[model samples]
Target: MRIAHATAATAAAALLTLLGTAPPATATTRPAGPPATTARPPAPIAWGSCPDSTADTRQQCATLAVPLDHADPTGPQLDLAVSRITAARPDQRRGALLIVPGGPGNPGLNGPTNAVRRLPRSVLDRYDLIGFDPRGVGRSSPVDCGLAHDDLSMTTLLPWPAPDGSVTGNLAAARRIADACTRNGGPVLRSISTRNEARDMDRIRQALGERRISAWGVSYGTYAGAVYATMYPDRTDRIVLDSNDDPDPSRVERGWLAAYATGAEDRFPDFAAWAAAPAAGDQRLADTPQQVRDLFLRLAARLDTAPLPWPGANPARLDGNALRAAMLDTLYDDARFPRLARLMLAADGRAELPPAATPPDAAMQNTVAASAATMCNDVRWPRSADGYARAVAADRTAHPLTAGMPVNVMPCAFWPTDPAEPPTRITPDGPSNILMVQNLRDPATPYAGALRLRAALGDRARLVSVDSGGHDAYAAHGNACGDRLVTRFLVDGRRPAHDTLCPAEH
Candidate 1:
């Protein structure tokens, strides 16, 4: 769910949506460590005023310098922009609770401000909410690949194949991006990876002077959290991993991307049902769910053959791949159903097309660069173009909704650097303080994947699966039961004795 999803209308507004707006990545299985550093007592932060964009007046900001490479701590340093809103009831304060954002590239400095609005007063009063931008992201020593603007688009970055399921263009793009990142992205970009992010987190913990830190990591953050908890097991107080990625160490990022195929299949029924409802009126695609599915498939295939001119869009056309991309993005949330419905209507010649949407070129460049680094560096990907073409061809037939993009080639196939360390394997070796919240039908990180993470954690974690269809399950989705379970766990340190399921809201 951490994978950023942008609509044609609001893609330019911001990089982060609800849980997050970028693709997700899984954690590794080996103990690649800079050696746990719980004994390093660091200096106190020099808190200062936050940016003008900060909405919460209580939020304070600061910077913590971490090594560009953890192995050599005294090497060049990178400043992480950190933010915090101290507990409202200092008397009731227990410890700090970090709000981990979803993307490997998503900025976390604004997370505390956003959490202040969503978190309950009881939880807010009991812990100081902390947030920070991971290395190579935002104000934390940002890195860019200086990619051509065309390569920055979600459609391209996501690796959607051609109408014929040919990966020829995708392979070319992978080489181009990889070469550019190596040419323009300096050491910082090369240093970006899931394990490194986990190291930076421990550095943040040391700087905070906390013996143990509690965290609520969502989407891509869940993998980061899993790695951190594994690396510094004893230093974790309370952990909540939401919308988890599959921790298939053998596959890592490849597994995460391939998950979209299953996730789309799991979640599409919800969209079909919604689109077929009588309330849909003019926007309704069909009278039944099956009919809606048929209609969408046919429409997309037709668009493949004859794309309509879309002046402001990246490719300046409403091609079948664009429709498919929008479908994947809209499937993340039910609230976005109408956007897809409207687009379908326009594509069907029943309504006018909406304006094109895309995130700022510079912002996407930074995000794509960091995201690609994290995935490519986490674990090696298959490098054969013919191998990828074969996989794409098979996936296209197996999962038409995704059109083989999930298994398509990416810049990682041509990455310039190898992973500095093995992906941290999530084991049952951590404390039993971790609690996970997941939606049964998450389009980004599916419930099946969450189960994998839960199994990996074993007795160290508990899961509260909510009967919902969306990306994030905790505070964003309106499931009071799931919310109460997570809130109680965070506020009082009480969790279900066993895995529990929260049924859908009536």
Candidate 2:
């Protein structure tokens, strides 16, 4: 039941790692064509030392001006923060390899630096690793809805239902959130859709003076990269989409939300086994995986009626939905398993409650607003309350862990505007230069969804499915086999002749 926005900052593999925008006038379809050209082509980037926080003098930063609304190129423009780590061996340089980070709201300014350290020297020597914050994000022109602190909580933002499964509160919250963005998001917010992001990427390519740019896109970024490949086939060189989403033009983000039910189900076994191990110590939940599952179910059901007082938490209590959301988040990475274990320990009266984790106020407001704008603006949601109620009830019965949140209401249901354009339909007509790497049990972008994207691309793409349990695939949770395959594809322009599956890393 964790919202997509909460998973935004989860892919900093190095840290373990540790760990938007505006509104616009009348919505219009994004323009389709070659990268923009002018009497004088976009000026070449004048790179300089990165911010002090980046602490990597080898990385350089620059800014590019892109139209706020691609459909209205003459309208106001926003500056996109861009960064790059030049190829180590210029003589072997192949081209630029752009890193497209996840979260329609997430920034990619530091991605190149991180990627350079993880990628093989062969690839690093051949490509100038590039990264940029998309419009209305990070160092880009950001937009915030100014939502109240409580409303910024993960539990509230995700639309968790009442104890009795009543969605009355969810409906009201969705409306309130949507109204806030409408009132404060301005024209830039309305411009934040997947199609526009792709267009902005093309603008970046033009500014970088690359006729054909290679890319490495992850999670939500996979979808954006696919759209870019679909819309501008000839302009792309090597393309890698890791942990992909289903490119169902009709459902898009709504489909991603619904997939969490199955995704969580697919991934929980790994956690149950981990939690039940002898090494788990006092944090262990049960003697066996089945027992662990039963324990969690019973605990959640009990909390529905009697939530525990949880000081420092937004709602100041540990309710069933909050527990469910925490479980979802913990399932994303095995490294996060202790978070749920500790929570369960506290709930069972075996330990004290851990301090709740809260993101910075400004960061939360900006990311939530941007996530809502992109999800809602990309496609229309079913506005009928009855329809949602039926879907949620059915989903809750089928997938108890998610507790109907997957099909529940979101701010998109109350969005004020229709999608500005139809989603880009992924097709096999594009160049067969795309390589996809995905984990079998990813909690955010599930393997089943990745299959859909693989199928959508037909022979144009090959998938290297890793038998793993986590969100990210390559160089993160993936086995060496999967990593080797991806490295070969990116570094040497070599790809397997067919879709292949690599055994899980032990």
In terms of TM-score, the best-performing candidate is 1
User: What TM-score does prediction 1 earn?
Assistant: 0.94
Give per-residue CA lDDT, model 2, range 156-227, as digits (tens): 777667767788887877888888888898877877878888888888888889999999998888999999
Which regions of candidate 2 deviate over 4 angstroms? 1-40
Q: Which segments of candidate 1 are over 4 A away from where they belong?
A: 4-31, 36-40
| lDDT tens digits, residue span 148-177, model 1 | 778766678778898888999988887888
Candidate 2: deviation at residue 345, Å?
Answer: 1.0
Task: Give the 10-residue window scoring lowest on summed lDDT in candidate 1.
Answer: 13-22
Q: What is the C-alpha local distance difference test score of each model?
A: 0.81, 0.80
